[model samples]
Target chain A: MIAILSGGVGAARFALGMRQIIDPTEISIISNVGDDEVLHGLHISPDIDTVTYTLGNAINPDTGWGLKNETWHAMDALTDYGGITWFRLGDRDLATHLFRTQLLSEGKTLTQVTDRIRKRWKVQPRILPVTDDELRTVLYSVIDGRAQQLTFQEYFVRYAHKPAVSRVIYEHSAEARMTPSVIQALENAEAIVIAPSNPILSIGPILAVPGVSEILSRRRERVVAISPIVAGQAVKGPAAKLMAELGLRQSAYGVAEYYKDIISAIVIDDTDAGLADQIRLLGIKTFPTNTLMTSPETSKNLASAALSMISGEPV
Target chain B: MIAILSGGVGAARFALGMRQIIDPTEISIISNVGDDEVLHGLHISPDIDTVTYTLGNAINPDTGWGLKNETWHAMDALTDYGGITWFRLGDRDLATHLFRTQLLSEGKTLTQVTDRIRKRWKVQPRILPVTDDELRTVLYSVIDGRAQQLTFQEYFVRYAHKPAVSRVIYEHSAEARMTPSVIQALENAEAIVIAPSNPILSIGPILAVPGVSEILSRRRERVVAISPIVAGQAVKGPAAKLMAELGLRQSAYGVAEYYKDIISAIVIDDTDAGLADQIRLLGIKTFPTNTLMTSPETSKNLASAALSMISGEPV
Candidate 1:
């Protein structure tokens, strides 16, 4: 079985491509929980939901998040009731949150709740949260001349990621250990693929989980990473902005360096070919190709390329 | 303030009539909370919502509950996800639950959360829950020749009120005292009205709150009840059937007897006129008229008659 480390939209799209190369049932996704939050008293795991919706063919193509054909009656009603509604929860999407919240309140772990959602969606990919315990990314940012700390949702959704983030702290990650299932998936995987996601916000928290770094370190030679950065920019989201703000390089070389200790190979975009030698200097094998996953066919090609890099087809 | 004891649809309809006679701002409704239940991990107070939505003119006139122009996207989606969708929660109605749940989770009392919902609806009536504490009405029923207990929502919504109920339990009602506002409204009311709600299921729970019965007893002379049953038939809901199952007389005289000590007068329907003398024998004055609240005019007339029966003008 192949294992993947994931964030939200970018990772979900990459997973879609990967599933095309291998059977969806053969893939296990370890999703970031730092962006998980409680909104309107409902537990929302954005990253896990993204992966589920994408795999289930229910995701809204325009937003790359939430469900398609979603209605906003609930949010509109909540808005009229003077409820805080900066985080837009579609009516169709709310069912997932409500069910998740119900299961969590009934003392089920996030992993169990996620499994229920995945099965309901008829998604074959095994999506597991990196940590079952609460682990949130808190962003310290300056918005409208006011310096404040905001939850990942508040920073990402409420402000539309407009504020200049000074720092990001992953709460509870240090104390949160990998779930047994996730640990087993990592241990049994023939190859590991780190999806092209926001490094600091998405993959950072997943790596920060206690013992996750050590596990990846042991399986370093079998791991590969696809750069979220293409040239000097992110194909989607605020990955480049957040990486630059957090005092990290916002290029393919930077991505390779970040995953250097955990990955033996890195897939850089065709535009970042000049950075191949630099990425190789980090003691990582560089594969320069059209990494921009815009269409299903192109994404499948990219997935195949990444898969072939693994020894013995990593079946 | 004119205080009214309420249940759900029937009581809301009666209150709709009362508001036509008196300014809605002058009315205080002490709604029963025994029907309250947590569905999908969201707190749902059906009685309180009915009153709030009806008074706010946001209620779907056809359903007698939920908001006008509401959508069922969330419930539909929840159904697709295999979550329980028996208690149909409309999309617009979900906002109330979400907001209430959030406030309650934030350590706010149900009263405070209810006030927020009321104000957001721009409703002028003082809608107060009988008690802020948990008071759920559980039904012990024999469905399909099997004996089992269920929540009020399950018995009502899930079972469609079809089960033969052996008993009705008001959980935690004995420990629940009236909220301060409800107590004050009761103490200062010109007239206390018992809306034409189900006696065994609706008004029964309100009367079960620890100190509420005593307060009504102290003001017995000014207490007036509008019989939900007219000519041994309920205008709405399972009042008649439940009363018969629970061993109470399913007639207006039964209603007068039900409130004998706390209510000095009762407004029965013209159809129940033949039972007036029997009701009078129960030490209660009877006001027989066209008490079927088929129209706003009839309901207002009924309200006016009940207001006039308060010993003094008590307007």
Candidate 2:
């Protein structure tokens, strides 16, 4: 089994690519729950849904999230009642949240609800939330000279990720234990691949889970990470901006440094090949290739290279 | 104030007519809470939304409920997940439920949520729920010689009211108290109008509230009920079937007999004029008219006739 530490859009795109080259049954995605939010009484797991929709081939290519050809009648109608809709939910996409919320209300765990949704979409790859407990990525930022704590969606979506975040804390991570499925996947996998998602907002929360990082560290020889940053910038989202704001280097080198403790190798874009020597100096193998997954072909190639590097094969 | 005891579709149409003939400010609609249901974790007050949409001229003309040109993408998408969708909710109409649920979670009463929605639609006149408490209309039905308890929505929407109901129960009505606004409206109104809705399922739940029936009895001289049953059949819904199933006469006279204790007069269809004498024999004044509200004009005419009867004027 090839387990993937995943987040939203970027990771979903990578999973779409990985499934093309390998039997989808071999993939196990342990998704980040730090970005989970309850809006209008409906539980929304942004990262989980992104992976589900992408793998199901129902994702909107334009937004890289939500359903394709989605209508905004529900969100547009919210304006009629002056309801909070900055975190817009599409009409067709609402069914997923509704199904999830309904099942959760009936006492099903997040992992169970996710599996139900995955099967509904005919997705073969196993998708599990990292932890069933409450694990939220909370960011503290200084706006107008006052410290404000923002939920992941509030920071990334509502605020457009503009606020200079001083700290990113994974709320409830101390008490949040890794789900048995996730632990088993990590323990039994031939290799673990960290998908190129926002490092702080996505992978950071997973690492914060008490036993998750320890497991990764013990199995570091088989772990490989795909850096979201290429040529000193993130391919998408606020990874680049947020990294600089939080005092981390906004480059491929920063990504390698961040995961050096638990990763045997890192995949950086060909454009960032100049940092290969620097990354290798940290005792981590560096595989520089065309990592910008502008198409399915490119994504599949990147996944192949990452897997090859972990198995000590020529990339 | 001219208070109206209300339910869904039929009551909304009557309210629309009342608004046309009188200053909307003079109208106070006390809506039934018996059919208020929570679906997909969203609080859905079917009757309240019907009246609000009708008064705002946004109701679907063909169905008498839901918003006009409403999209069903959300409900259609639910089927993909095998989600329970026997109770279909339109995409645009879902905004009301989402808004109501969010506000209710924030500690607002159903009455407050209804008012917020009313203002959003620019609807005039006060629309108050009979009670903010849990007063569900539960139907005890025998299906294949087995007794089953069904919620109002389950019996009405899910089962299509096919099961023969043995008894109708207003769950928690014994402990439910009428809202102060409803009581005040009844106390201050010059006359009260019971709309042409299902008596057992609609108005029955409102009267089940402890103080509500007492207030109507005290104002019996000024209270009038518009029979939902016309020509020995209901204009819409399962009123006739349920009435007969519950051992009621299932006619205009039966409607009058049902409310005889708390009502002074009733407006029945001209086709049921033969039963007028029998209704009067029961000491309830009867007014015969064309009460089939096929159009807005007909509804307005019916509203005018009912008001004239209360004022002792010729219809």
Candidate 3:
């Protein structure tokens, strides 16, 4: 079994490529829930939904999230009431939130609800949230000389990730324990892949959960990380910008430094070959390759290379 | 000021007629909350929406409820997850539930949410729920030779009102208190109307709230009811069937008898003129008129006639 630590769009795209080289049934995706939010009384797990929609082949290609051919009637109608429409929940995508929220209210765990949803979408991989307990990624930033604390979405979406964040904290993570499913996935996997997602915003929440980082650190040899940074820039989203704001070098070397303690190998884009030796100096094996993943074939090749580093097998 | 005790479709239609004679701002509608339900984590007030839609001219003319050009995309998508779609929520209608649920979760009362919703619909009348507390109408019925207890929506919508009801009870009416707005509307209105809605299922719930029936009975001379029945049957719905099952005479006379204690006068259809003397014998003045309300003009004339009984003015 192969386990992937995932975030949202970037991770979903990486999972799409992972599917090409492995049987989906053999994959287990332990997803981050720090970005999950309650808007309009609906529990929305953005990362989990992104993974589900992308794996189900229902994702909007333009947005890299939400459903293709989705309608905004519900959101549009909400505008008449002067309701909060900044979150952008589409009509078709609302069914998932409704189903999840209703089931959760009926005393079902997030894990059980996610299982039902993925099966309904005909998605083969097992997708488990890192923890069922509340864990919000809160950002501390000073915008216009006034210090403010914002939810991850507020910093990323509402503020368009423009504010310089001083620190990011996972709220309630101190009391959060890994769900049994997630723990079992981490323990039973033959190999683990830290998908190319935002380090602080996505994977940071997963590592914050009690015992998660310890387990990864102990089994470092079986773990490999694909850097989100390619050629000194993030392929999408604010990974590079957030890293820079947080005082980390915004390059492949920086991604390697972030996961160096929990991973034995790191995959960097070929354009950043100059940084490979510097990353290796941190006691992490750096494999420089074409990690841009602009298409299905490129994504697959990237996944194969990352797997090969740990497996020592020719694909 | 004029106040109307209301239910769903029939009451909404009557309200439309009332709007034609009085300035909408001068009208106050005290609506029943017995039929309110929580479905898919959404707080749905079917009667409130019906009144708002009907008065705003956005109601589906064919069904007498829901939006005029509603789409069912959200409900359809729910089917993919084997989620409950029995209640038939439309995409456009979902915004109301979402808005209400969010506000209520934020500690706002149902009365406050309803006020906001009505204003958003451009509805001018003051629509207030009979009570902000939980008050569910539960029906005791014998269906397929088995006795069962059913919610108002379950009996009326899910089962299509086919079960023979032995009795009906307001589940939480004992603990329910009338909202201040409802009490004020009843006390300050020049005339109070009991709309042409099902007495046992619709109006019954409103009266069940504490102090509601007492206020109407104290001011009996100012309160008049428009009988939903014409001749020997209800204008719409299973009002006659339910009344017969509950052992009441299935006629306009039965309606007067049911409300005789609180109502001083009643307006029945011209077809039921023969029952007038019998209803009047019970000490309730009966006015026979063309109460079919087949069109806007007819509805307006019926409202004018009902208003004239107490006001003694040519409306």
Model 3 CA deviation exceeding 4 Å by range: A143-146, A312-315, B142-147, B312-315
How does chain B score by TM in each prediction? 0.97, 0.97, 0.97
Chain B TM, cand. 2: 0.97
Better of 1 and 3 by lDDT: 3
Q: Report the lDDT tens digits of candidate 1 across residue range B113-140.
A: 9998899878888899999988888899
Whole-model alpha-carbon lDDT for candidate 2: 0.91
Work out the TM-score per prediction: 0.95, 0.94, 0.96
CAPRI quality band, candidate 3: medium
Candidate 1 has an fnat equal to 0.75
Clashes of each: 0, 0, 0
Rate residue A7 of model 3 by lDDT.
99
For model 3 chain A, the run of ten residues with the poorest summed lDDT: A306-315
Give the per-residue lDDT of model 3 (tens digit) for B180-211.
89999998888899999999999999999989
True contacts kept of each: 0.75, 0.79, 0.66
Candidate 3 chain B weakest ten by summed lDDT: B306-315
Candidate 1 or 2, higher TM-score? Answer: 1
Give the per-residue lDDT of model 1 (tens digit) for A1-315: 889999999888888899988878989999999999887778899999999999999999999998898889989888887887888899999999998988888899999999999999899989999989879899998777888999988888888888888898898877898999899988889988999998888999999898888988998877899999997899988888888888888888888888889998988888898998888788888888999888998888888778677776443
Best by the DockQ measure: 2
Distance from true location, Cα of B139 in model 2, Å: 1.2
Interface Cα RMSD in Å, per prediction: 1.1, 0.7, 0.8
